[model samples]
Target: MSIEELNQELTRLRQCLQQLKTDNAELRQAVLEYTTQLKQHKSEQQAALLERQRIEEQLQTTQQFLYSVIQTMPVAVFVKDVVDLRIVLCNQAAEKLAGVSADEILGKNDYDLFPREEADFFTTRDREALNSKKLLEIPEEIIRTKSGETRILQIKKAPILDSQGQPKYLLVVRYDITEHKQAEAQLKQQAIELEQTLKELQSTQAQLIQSEKMSSLGQLVAGVAHEINNPVNFISGNLTYANKYIQQLLNLLHLYRINYPNPAQEIQMTIQEMEFDFLVEDLLKLLSSMEIGAERIQQIVVSLRIFSRLDEAELKAVDIHQGIESTLSILEHRLKPRANHVEIQVLKDYDDLPLVECYAGQLNQVFMNILSNAIDALEEALIQGKLSHNHPQIRICTQQLNAQQIVIRIIDNGLGIPEQVKQKLFDPFFTTKDVGKGTGLGLSISYQIITERHGGSLECVSSLEEGAELIITIPVVQPKQ
Candidate 1:
């Protein structure tokens, strides 16, 4: 009985021991799993902390870069609150421009720093920008700083929107533009002045041309008068003789009648006293002289009328040669008055040229100026002993350069202009002659009429101690644009 009982108890004890060992092994596995889980959680937390630090550093760098960029920009930048229209933010440029520190200007309205009028203008513009929710640019404006310095500003304004698409602030940018505007104004003024000067010069030139023409006309009148005086005097003497002869013839008739009436002695005495035969011969001679004188006077009057046709205002096709002849007639007096030892000879090389379309009166003036100057040159040469024994000559040549162009040259052997004087010969009020003797405008006006008014060219060529040649080239036909 004892042996069976012992074996059963031992078996029970062995079973319990095995169960305890299994529970211990399970507990050890559970501890190792918990330790691995704790280690993994610590590693994840450390990685998250490092990521957060890196993002913070990046955010700080971005803020610093934006601040630096805004401060260094040339344009003044400012921001205002939309609701209150008060300045909320301003850059360093804006602060400097306003002549105030940032602390004093922040949160201040425009009215606090500027006059009421200026403030209202700024506020109106800001409101318009905010209402439109678009950029507004003003090309120019007047801005006054806190230091009372005024400047012209070019401004651009834009509205800033919040995340909800609501207007949050107004952004304004400004640049000074005073100097540029001033320069533009000055340039415009200078242009106006230049235009006025050109007009004045043109007017002065026209007056000069008129004066030269009048002088030529006066000379022409004197010459025509002198030429007619001799014929008129002869005609007057012949008419007186003819009247005396007619009286004598009447007396002879009366004496013959009386003698037949039975008074022979008295009739014979009257006939002898009258000298009837001689009176008859003289009367015929006087009548012939009077007829010749009347014809000569008619010719002069016709020539004068033809030459003065230039006084008309209408433009016409005119023969250039005829115009030249008329000008010579006008200058005839000047030539004869100085006809001493100096012989004035004219060499004409006129070609068969077509009529030119021009203002006859104005063109005549141009011719008169040139011809008068030439005559004066010859006179000067005579007075200065430069024309001794040598023939003082004037040459006039006309030629058709082409179908559309004509050239006329006037050459004179006189005291030629010096190079220095020649450069300014066409300048108004410049003359080599004494004051009151010559008006310094003849050549200047001639230049304007030839070049500016008629689109022709008038040029002078001369050498020291040589002769002067004036060449005028004009277009025969004006071209249509």
Candidate 2:
């Protein structure tokens, strides 16, 4: 019994040992698996920490770069909180513009930094920018610094957006523009002064040229009139006597014919062959024609003298109509028909006017210029086939405008001047004619004569295809210097 029991106990003991070995093996495997899992978790934690550190460094670098950009800009830059419109960030330029330190400017609202009116304006603009989420530009604004100095500025405001596309802050930029504005104004003033000086120089030049021209013309005309006057006086004086002698001779012949009714055959044949009766009538007719021609020559000589007016240099009361007629006489040849061109007819409407106090010779010269220009316009119309009326004509009208003033108007039926061309018509050296055909100073000088020399006004009215009218108004008595 002891042996059997011993053998059974030994087998049980071996089985139990085997069971314990299996359990120990399973326990070792579980411990190894737990150790491997713990190592993997620790590695994952380390990688996450490294990535977080790297992100923090990148964020710091980006902030530094943005700050540097804002600090170095030339313009005054400010950043404000969207909620309270309070300034959160400012650059050195902003501090200088405000004439204050950054410590005082930071975390302050516009109301605290500026006057009430300026603050209101700034706040309104900030709100508008934030609400619209767009950039706003102000072309100009006035700002008073801490030193009480006024300055002009151009400003721009923009809303900074966040990741969710919402406004986070307001950014403002301002540029000083006072000096630029002042320079622009100075340039404009200088330009005006230069233009005035140019006008004065041109006027002086015109006066000199016209004076020389008028003097030369006067000398030549005076000489011609003197020469013609002597001849015309002699011829006119002799024609009267010759006419009387012819009448006496005809009376003597009549007496002989009455007294010697019966004559010798030879004498009667002579009288018949000579046609004595017809000869007597024809001779009287010839004498009458000679007298008329002599008178016409005398009148022409007088007209020439009047037109010269070399001695009438000072202002004097003159017959305006006589001066006009003299100018027409001088330009008669130009008014006549030319090759392939019709005659230019002139119509006059005269009013009763008193003698005007003016320089006679100078006034005549003005008349000559205006009339010549009218003729040129008519001729140009004919050349270009732009004449509205078949008969190219000039109309001259005169009237007393008031008790102290008189007006004259010269109108033409021709191709009218364009508005653009008419504006510069009175300028010196401005002309529509060929370079050689015109000096281009005639109208300019005429304008000076009427306005500056005689204290008058000259105006031109014209339209395209509707002809032109030039009007002149002058005082009857000039103002005393």
Summing lDDT over every window of 10 consecutive residues in candidate 2, give the lowest-scoring window. Answer: 296-305
Each candidate's root-mean-square deviation in Å?
A: 21.9, 6.1
Compared with the true structure, what per-residue lDDT tens digits does model 1 show for residues 1-481? 5977888888888899898989888888988888888888888888888888888888889988887888889878898999888998888988888998999989899998899999999999999999999999999999888888888899999999999887999999998777787888898999899976886776566575565666576457546756776777677667777667877876886687666765579766876698756766776776777767676565455445445563444557788888788667656666553446455788999989999876665676788788888877777778787755467788999999999889999998887879998898888767888878777777878887788767899999998668789998888865543
Candidate 1 lDDT at 292 equals 75
How big is the positional error of residue 121 in model 2, measured in Å on the Cα after superposition? 9.3
TM-score of each: 0.46, 0.68
Best by TM-score: 2
Error of 1 at 363 (Å): 1.4
Candidate 1: lDDT over CA atoms?
0.79
> Candidate 2 overall Cα lDDT vs. reference?
0.88
